[model samples]
Target: MNQTQILVIGRHPEILATVIRLVNNNPAWNATGCITDEEAMSTFDKQTFAMVLLGGGIEEPSEDKLCAYFTSRNPDIKIVQHYGGGSGLLSAEIYEALE
Candidate 1:
């Protein structure tokens, strides 16, 4: 089976690193981390991602716009929410559903 590709939008280096590690550690994911919304959007426009991780610090308007754009472009992509510091953003059920 092919691993799912994930795009992460976050500012903090530590949080991005942790998320990259988590997603990469999972046998099912191919994680790629981006710091800025522009970079994330650029990546999104270039390639298809199975999921996207949105950091709490990210501007909701920009994130929402991106989500809408990506969903319109490809409805199969899932957007998962996350906090800036670490985990616990989504409930286990939501996480499992996103996964």
Candidate 2:
């Protein structure tokens, strides 16, 4: 079966790890986490993701830059600002984006 692709970016490694774990829990989804904008962009350029999860620790400037870069690459891309919520909210956000 094919799985949905998701790119997650967070400033904190621990938070990013948690997000990655939660995202990977879903059998139908696959996620990649990055702690830096450059890494995120580099990963993004290598593959296509249906959605992007931005962590709370990300700065406004970085967020703007990332969003701009992603939008430039895929205007229809889905971007979500995730603030360390439980798995339920994360799933809901992902489901909502796919909807």
Candidate 3:
């Protein structure tokens, strides 16, 4: 079985770690976390991610740019904003986006 690759972008280390852990809990999913837009863009260039999750720690303008970057690269890529919800909500959002 192939797992879905998820790229999580956030400025906070703790939140990024939590999001990575939650996404990886499901066997069908794999996740990578980036602390800055530069890191995220670099990783995105090297990877084929199915989705990108923008965490609450990222500012509005940065998030917008990241979203634009990813979407421009892959027009159909799924990008979702995450605002520190529980693991369940996070999981649900991810699955929904993938679906």
Candidate 4:
């Protein structure tokens, strides 16, 4: 099976790490976490991702910009807003986004 590439954008290091770990738990998914907009953009340019999870820690304007950037680059890319939740919720949200 092809692993789905997921980009996680957040300002909090712990949250980012946790989300990355959660997403990576699924063998079908590979996740990359970025703490800054610049890093996110650079990573986005370097690879093709199936989805992007914008963490609650990001500022509203930054999140909006990142969503716009991702959609503009690939209209089919799925963008999901992720507030901190349990592993089950995270998995559900990711699965929903993929569908």
- lDDT: which candidate is best? 2
Which residue ranges in model 4 land beyond 4 Å of their true spot? none
Candidate 2 vs 4: which has more TM-score: 2
Question: What TM-score, to 2 decimals, does candidate 3 have?
Answer: 0.97
In model 3, where do residues sit more than 4 Å from their true spots?
none
Task: State each model's C-alpha RMSD to the native.
Answer: 2.7, 0.6, 0.7, 0.7
TM-score of 1: 0.79
Candidate 1 or 3, higher TM-score? 3
Tens-place lDDT digits, model 4, residues 1-99: 999999999898998899999999999999999999999999999999999998887888888888888899999999999897789999999999999
- Cα lDDT computed for each candidate against the true fold: 0.75, 0.93, 0.92, 0.92
Worst 10 residues of 1 by lDDT: 85-94
TM-score of each: 0.79, 0.97, 0.97, 0.96
TM-score leaderboard ranking: 2, 3, 4, 1
Prediction 2 TM-score vs. true: 0.97
lDDT at position 73, candidate 1 = 78
Q: Could you tell me which residue pairs clash in candidate 1?
A: none
Model 3: per-residue Cα lDDT over 1-99, one tens digit each: 999999998888988898899999999999999998999999999999999988887888898889889999999999998897799999999989988
lDDT of 1: 0.75
lDDT of 4 at 2: 92
